[model samples]
Target chain A: MAEVRLVDVEKRYGGFLALPKQSLTIEEGEFLVLLGPSGCGKTTTMRMIAGLEEITSGDILIGGERVNDKPPKDRDIAMVFQNYGLYPHMTVQQNIAYPLKLRGVDRKAREARVRETAEKVELGALLHRRPSELSGGQRQRVALARAIVRTPKIFLMDEPLSNLDAKLRVSMRAELKHLHHELGVTTVYVTHDQMEAMTLASRVAVMREGRIVQLDTPKKIYSEPADLFVAGFIGSPSMNLVEGHITGGRFEAPGVSIPVAAAERGDVVLGIRPEDLELTTAEAPPIRGKLYALELTGEATLVTLREGATSICARGPAEFEAEIDAACALAPRPGARIHLFDKTTGQRIAA
Target chain B: MRDRSLQYVLLVPAFVIVLATTFYPLAYSLTTAFRDWDLTRSRRPEGWVGFDNFAHAFTESHFLNSLWVTTIFVVTSVALTLVIAMSLALLLRRKGRMHTFTRVVLILPFAMSPALIGVSYRFMFNPEFGVLSNGLAAIFPWLEGTAWLADPELAMAILVLTDVWHWAPYMTFMCLGGLASIPRETEEAARIDGASNIRIFFGIILPQMKGVLLVTAILKTIFALKMFDQVVTLTGGGPGTSTETLAYFIFNVGFEWYDMGYASALAWILTAIMMTISIWYVRMLLSERKMATA
Candidate 1:
């Protein structure tokens, strides 16, 4: 396994900067995921590392060697494309054995390794079938098998599980985690799915508009988001961001009032996770609004409340029931972390 | 029942046109192939010939020469056209101002009529005053004053060249269409799998292009077998029947020699060859599809 380093890397498409200058070091054998929405340059970064895209400026070093001049074939890296990229004319056995064949491995040994890799991916039965005969999930397994078959120094996966159905994606995600654990190969995965990043990555790099906005472990990034964007992006039923001001040591808006450690400031935004808030019946709760929408989500109910211009969502018990436009109160659960950010800059306000 | 009857009524006009244009001629020819009908000797068929007309083809020296000539022409022209079209497709697949301009210019040759192409090449390869002849003589002194369309081999070579020029661009467009359908990810994946550029093309791109190439070869073969206009306009069945292709020979037998029964039999033979190739192509394509889905 090899560690990959991008030093002051910048990508420009005819003066339109696609990726701003940035440096990142992916530790050896670590599953680092670059996560962002579309047009965020996450794929661009991975392609550059795979030697598929030319770097406008900067050096990419893999395993401590500058490989900017090396072709992809010489870079000792295997990539699983988002579309699977299986050879339609070849059988699954040939597709998985291609890298070994390219390396001039003998026929007998190549067949053995291909079988072993196919069995690992549970594809032994379908080795004779072409990609057109396989299901979407099976095709994904073939792409994965091809990459791991050769045991390249690093593996680059560009949203490999995105094409599968939701249920298959979850199972495939678990398989990928297990594969990484078993192989211990340095992998750089690029995806727009936050849940995949949280589940599969050793560290997640949240990117926005060509820059790495936050690069941290999944738990740390979840608990302490770097700014307003991370706070809103990292959570399901996303964190409620109230645009208000801190006054008299309390953050206050039209329908919300909460104590904060920050000093008095006018343009402050309050960030709180939906899971951190509990439905309360107290006379004077920290958050008071009229119930707007209630959605049952199997294990919990999503309760949204609106007061004037401020809207908030909180996770309540599955049996929680309330009428629309009725008065609703919500208070922070004990030991729930409260986040504050500067409204003008979208920067976190340390307390 | 009324709608079904109306559908049949609607198809009647098309059926009549097809019968008048296609089926009638085909049936008339099939019968004519087995009869003795010399236009100069009789207005109607003179007598039944059985397999005599078809049998006469094997014994005729000129017919055998034309058959040999056609085989050479078809094989060489189809191979040359396929290679040139595939290379042009690869070169023009990428986007650029120059490539776009070249692609637009490439259509000119294909757009020209085959007869026109024949006429132009005949003029260009004229021994004394032709521009191509003069240009080649200037580049290579030994080529000066060479009778390009007089020699048997050179005449056949020029014939093949003209056909390739006329068809290669159209076939290149077909190849480009085939290339466009292949996903770019497969090539990138191959590169990452440590396959060289050449290996990726031969292993990945060329294999995927099998269906398209086969279709192109079959089409070129059919067109080559039926090649008549160029033979007439370029060399007029050559300087002593040296480049007399089968279609030109059939024309000679019917119109020049007034041997209608023999000409019909020879035309049927050419049709049989084309039909055989087409059937083979269809079978290959079906098997390829089966393998892909298996």
Candidate 2:
């Protein structure tokens, strides 16, 4: 296994920068995920690392050697595309053995390795079938098997599980994690799915507008987002922000005076996770707001509260005890969970 | 019942026209093939000859040699057309302004009239005023006085060459459509799998184009088999009967030599060969489809 590093790598398509001055280092055997919304340069970053895309500037070093000019095969990296690009013409056996054949591996050893890898992906029975004959999930297994059979130095997965159904996607996500743990190969996975990134990566690189906003463990990124973009992008239901003035160490709106840390004493974007909001009686003046609606999603219910013009969503227990249009108080969770970002720069304020 | 009567009324005129235009001539040819009739003794027929004319047509040196020439022309021209067309398709299949321009230029020849192309090539190989012959002779002294249409081999070479030049572009356009319809992700996947461009071309691109290529080969083969216009225009059965193809030989026997009985037998032979080849081509395509879908 080899660690893959990008030192100030940049990509531009005739002055339209796809990835601008991005740098990242993935440890050997680490599952580092590049997670962002669409058009965030995450896929471009993965493609650059896999040598599928050219690096316009800076060096990409794999296993401590500059691989900027190296071809994909010479770089010893295997990529599993989101489409599960199993060769439609070749049977599962041939598709899995393609890399081995390209590398000049012997037939006897190649077949043995394919068998072993196919078993790892639970595809032994389907080897004789072509890709078109296989199911969606089976095609994904074949794609994974093709990438892993050669035991390349690094595995670059560009949302490999995205093509599978929701149920299969989750199962394959777990399987990919288990496989990565078992093989201990450095893997760089790119996905727009925040949950997939949270579940799979040792370090998730959260990117925005061609630059990385934060690159840290999933827990760290979620708990302490570096900027408004990271705070808004990482979590489900997304972090809700109140655009109010931080007057007298407390944010003030038309009908609200919510608590803010003493340091953030200006116009700021007061951020709160959906689960961070606590519902209280209307009589109590803890940022009073009318309950707009409640949406139940099995595990949790999203409670939308309106204080004047702004609407804030709060996640309560599945059976939320609140009525629509009922006046309720919202108290932001105290301490580190409450994020305050400068409205002008959108950067997190020091507390 | 009224709708059925109306449909029958509409079809009756078309049916009469079809029989008079198509079937009557076909039946007359079959009847003539079995009789002894010629322009010299022109009646419907004198008596039944049955297989006598067939045996004579097969044994005739001129007819057999023309059959060989036609086979050579069809096989060589169709094979060369597919090869050149597929290459042109691949070369211009890339998505760009220049590739689009090249594609348009390549298909322009297919729109030109075949007779016009034959007439043009006739003048181009005139050996005296022909630019091609003059250029070739200037470059190589051996071709200074060579009349390309005078020699039978050279005449047949020019025929196959002109046929390929005119029709290969049509095949190229067909194969281009086939190639363009393939998913771009497939090639990207192959490239990421570390297959070189050459490997991708043979293993991935060519195999995918097989269906369209097969259709191109069959259509070109059928057209090439009836090689007449270029032969009649360029060589006129040439120095001897050496350059006469099966179609030209049939025309010679029926219209020029006035040997209708022999020409009808020759027509039947050509039709039988064409039917066999077509059946084989279709069977091969069906098997390929089964394999791809396997």
Candidate 3:
């Protein structure tokens, strides 16, 4: 396994800066995921680490050696492309055995290792079939098998599970986590799926535009978002952000009032998670609004309330029932963390 | 019933066109291949010749020589054109102003008529005042004053060169179409798998191009076997029947010698060769489709 370090790296396409200068160090044997929406430069960063894309400036060091000028073949890294990239004309056996053959491994050893890798990926029965004959999930397994077959110093996966169906993606995600645990190889995964990042990564780097906005463990990022973007982007239903101001030690807006720790401010945004709010019938609850919508999601119901210009969503019990446009009140559950942010700058206010 | 009759009426024009254009000549030739019909001796077919006209082909010295010449021309031209076309495709597939301009320019040779290409090459290879002849002599002094179309080997080589020049660009466009269908991710994956650029080409790209190359070779083979225009315009069966390809020989037998029966038999033989290759090509394509869908 190797540590991948990007030191003051920047990428520019002509006059447009694709990735601003940034430094990141992915620890050895760590599963670091670059998570963001499309056009966020997450894939660009992974490609640069794989030696597939040229870094416009600064240096990339793998295992403590500068790899700025090294070709991909000389970098001792194996990658699983988003499209699987399996050879369409080659049988599964040949596809998995290619890296071994290229490294000049003897024929007998190559066959043995290929079989072992195939069995690990549960592909032993389909070794003779070409990629065109396999389903998409099978093709993904073949791509994964090929990367792990050679045991390269680092593995780069560029959203390898994105093409599979939702059910298969979850199972494959588990398999990937198990494989990383078994192999202990440094892996850099890129995806726009927040759930995949939360489940698979040792640390998630949330990127926006061209910069790393937040890089932290999944739990820490979920509990304490760095700013308004992270607070909205990390959660499933997302944190409700109410634009209001702190006055008389209480955050207030039309049809809403909430006590806060922050001092009186003109423009403050309140951030609260859906799971942190509970249905309440208190005469003067912290949050009061009219029920707008309700969605049942098996285990829980997503309840949305709108008060004037402010809209908030909260997770209620699965059996919770209410009429639309009815008056509603929601109060924070005990020990629920309350977040505050500066409205103008979208920066987190010190609490 | 009215719609059925209308369907039949709609197909009548196509059937009549096929019968008049394709079947009539084919049936006429098949019957004439077994008969004795010399135009100078009789205006109509004289008698049944059985296999006599077909047998005459194996025994005639000129016919055998023409067969040998055709074999050489077809083999050399197809191989040379395929290699050059594939190389050009590889070079021109990438995007750039220079590559696009070269690709546009490459179509000029293929766009020219085969007869016109032969005429141009004949003029360029003229012994005394030809541009190519003098250019070669300037580069290599020993080649000065050489009679390019007079010598048997040089004449055949020039014939193959002109054919390759006419067809290679068209075949290069075919190869480019084939190259475009291949995904770029496979190559990038190969690169990360520790395969060098050369290894990736041989191991990944070339194998995927097998179907396209086979189609190009078979199509070129069919074209080469029927090569007649160049033979007439460039070499004209040459200094002494040295470059007398089979199609040219068949022309000589029917028009010059007025031996219709013999020429018909020879034409049938050429048709049989082309038919056999075409059937094999179709079968290969069908099997490839089956493998893909499997």
Best by TM-score: 1
Of the two candidates 2 and 3, the one with more favorable lDDT, higher being better, is 3
* TM-scores for every predicted model: 0.98, 0.93, 0.95
lDDT of each: 0.93, 0.85, 0.93
Q: Per-residue lDDT tens digits of candidate 3, residues A1-351?
A: 999999999999889999999999999999999999999999999999988899999999999999999999889999999899998878999999999999999999999999999999999999999999999999999999999999999999999999999999999999999999999999999999999999999999999998899999999989888889888889899999999899998989877788888888888889999999999999899999999999999999999999988899999999999899999999989988999999888888889
Give the per-residue lDDT of model 2 (tens digit) for A1-351.
998889988899987878878678999999999998899999988888878789899999999999988777788888888888667778899999988887789999999999999999999998899888888888888988998988889999988888888999999999999999899999999999999999999999998888888999999999989989998888889998887777667777755677666654657788889888766654646467788888899998888888778888888778777667887777765542778888899998876
Model 1 stretches with alpha carbons more than 4 Å out: B1-7
Worst 10 residues of 2 chain B by lDDT: B183-192
lDDT by residue (A1-351, candidate 1, tens digit) is: 999999999999887999999999999999999999999999999999999999999999999999999999899999998899999989999999999999999999999999999999999999998899999999999999999999999999999989999999999999999999999999999999999999999999999999999999999999999998888889898999999999999999998989988898899899999999999988889999999999999999999999998999999999999789999999999998999999999989998
Q: CA lDDT of A124 in candidate 3?
A: 97
- lDDT score of residue A347 within candidate 1: 89
Question: Pairs clashing in candidate 2?
Answer: none
Model 2 per-residue lDDT at B167: 94
In the range B197-258, model 3's lDDT, one tens digit per residue, is 78888889888887888889889999999999999999998969888999999999999999
DockQ of each: 0.75, 0.49, 0.69
Quick one: RMSD of model 2? 2.6
* Superposed model 2: Cα runs more than 4 Å off: A254-256, A263-267, A285-287, A321-323, A333-336, B1-20, B43-48
Candidate 1 lDDT by residue in tens digits, B1-294:
999999999999999999999999999889999999999889987799799999999998988999999999999999999999999999999987698789889999988888988899999999888999999999999999999999999999999999999999999999999999888999999999988889889999998998888888888889998999999999998888889999999998999989898999999999998899899988998787677666
Residue B293 lDDT, candidate 3, scale 0-100: 61
Which candidate has the highest DockQ of all? Answer: 1
